[model samples]
Target: MTDTSKNETNATGAPVTDEAPNTASADVEALQARVAQLEKEVAEYKDQWLRAVADYKNVKRRTDQERADLIRGASAGLILKLLPVVDDLERAMNSVTPEVYASQWYSGFKLIPQKLQTVLDSEGVTPIAAVGADFDPNFHEAVIYEAAGEGQGGKVVAELQKGYMQRERVLRPAMVKVGQE
Candidate 1:
């Protein structure tokens, strides 16, 4: 065999090898391909991670909104039950004589329901209109129907029981009497 070290140099004056050069080039190409593939995989994994994080944030926001809504509804129900007591106090205060208004007990009773109603109004609880308007099935329940004197049909003649709303949602339907033609 010829001396490989002596035959290694090519005509371009660059050092050349018999086996090591080709082997080294092939190994470098393989390493580059491997690096490209790993980069693509890393990018895919990063995209998946970003999507997962966004989904988790959306779920957390939805849960917080629902919890807040539940708390508001619970408070509204308690206030709704107290409205009848307020109405009774109003009646009592209206019917009280001048001598009774001068008494401490009568003044205390009058102030209590008014304060309660003021608090409820500040919290978005409101009474629905049910008297003399057209009866609506969505907000009013007609327990009694009667024929009016003239030109009255599908109109609410009387409200037997009051209704209430909280933030555009009906908390209770009005019990009413409707006039029919």
Candidate 2:
């Protein structure tokens, strides 16, 4: 048996090997098998690369959402701190006498509180309902319990200090007086 790939011609110029067909078929099969293996490996690597890119995109999207949320709610702490001042202003307005209420100074004082409320409204800060509504632990903190009429048990009778919410989060839980039988 001659190795046809390196076979030399005899003096008559005829090749010595009789295995041309077998050699060609075997070489074709080997080349076909190598091509298939390369294709399979390429497909596997492409799948992995696609998954990695998708994972990176998902992480980037999540980070962007978190950053936006942080920027949107950055004023929450300052608003929380200023609520006590707002409460004091409201109390002062409630304690004013009719004589003082008609004075220029009283009107100016009233406008200040109104401006504070306007500022709160502009920031999406909203006052939680306490009076007459059912007492909710999520929105109200019961500081004192008071006597209630029928059908009013477990309801808020008064708000000692107003509670506030920014967006959907409770910035301050309303200090309230709950009523019971």
Candidate 3:
């Protein structure tokens, strides 16, 4: 005769008891907790990745701006070297006799300074007007101080060498003669 008080045997042949239900519920609660934790971690990782992408974009923009600024100022040195040649050409043109000035060769020679000036203009180089303007130490370098004539006190009487500005910045100061009171 079979004993009725014996525990029930499952398909696996293991004796099942009331403790099986409690253990299965505990496992389900633990799995839910683990899923929540994994979700939280994934959110944090996503936020960090987004921040990294933003930082990279900012750095790239800054680098591009710096490169453009560098390119704009790169021609400054060469232009500085060419300034003396321009000065010489202007002096020669100014000293020309009336007979020589009327010659055909003088007309062709005059084009050289015009071309150089065009190049300077395209590069944003502009000559500073010093003569007759009030002398400022920033844009004018005083080479001589002479007695003021009429209303010329504290003004630039003459510019020995022309000053130039590249863009908004002074590339070279004018060598000038100032009028003194």
Candidate 4:
């Protein structure tokens, strides 16, 4: 005397209901939605991490450049200060006549300037080409403009003071006399 109206049963007496398929389908849909949400979150996190890594690389590159610039700048200042001494030495050496330069003491004077040049070279210092080159304000400061002939016009005819650079950056512009055509 089982009540047939209360529940419907299959062959082994398990209750069968019309809502079962709907319930299982709803659960599957919910699980699929959760999976999609998690995937989106993962994608977002990955994007953020990649951006952070890229930012770090940029910062590192900037830091290295700054460090190199600082080192170069420090040397530039020191070299600028020493330029006058080098100029004086050159002047002294040039003033000596060829006969006087042949003296034993002259060798010592020559060595001093050569050693200074070697130090300057090792520090990446270079002289700006002023005499005979086209006068450029970036590398030469015009001290005077003089009348010139033919090819000498608009070019540096004389360097009043030698200009120097450190690693391509101008430490001082060369004082020059420019030719006026």
Against the true structure, whose lDDT is highest? Answer: 3
Better of 3 and 4 by TM-score: 4
Better of 1 and 4 by TM-score: 4
TM-score of each: 0.82, 0.80, 0.79, 0.85
Looking at model 1, residue 162 earns an lDDT score of: 80
Q: In order, how many clashes per candidate? A: 0, 0, 0, 0
Candidate 1 per-residue lDDT, tens place, 33-67, comes to 99999999999999999999999999999999999
Highest-scoring model, TM-score: 4
What TM-score does model 4 achieve against the real structure?
A: 0.85
Model 2 off-target regions past 4 Å? 1-16, 97-100, 103-111
Q: RMSD in Å for candidate 1, one decimal?
A: 3.8
TM-score for candidate 1, residues paired by index: 0.82
**How large is the C-alpha RMSD of every model relative to the true structure?**
3.8, 4.2, 3.4, 3.1
Worst 10 residues of 1 by lDDT: 6-15
- lDDT per model vs. reference: 0.85, 0.90, 0.92, 0.92
Better of 1 and 4 by lDDT: 4
Residues 39-101, candidate 3: write the lDDT tens digits.
Answer: 999999999999999999999999999998888777888888899998899899899999999
Report the lDDT of model 3 for residue 148: 87
Cα error, candidate 4, residue 165 (Å): 2.2
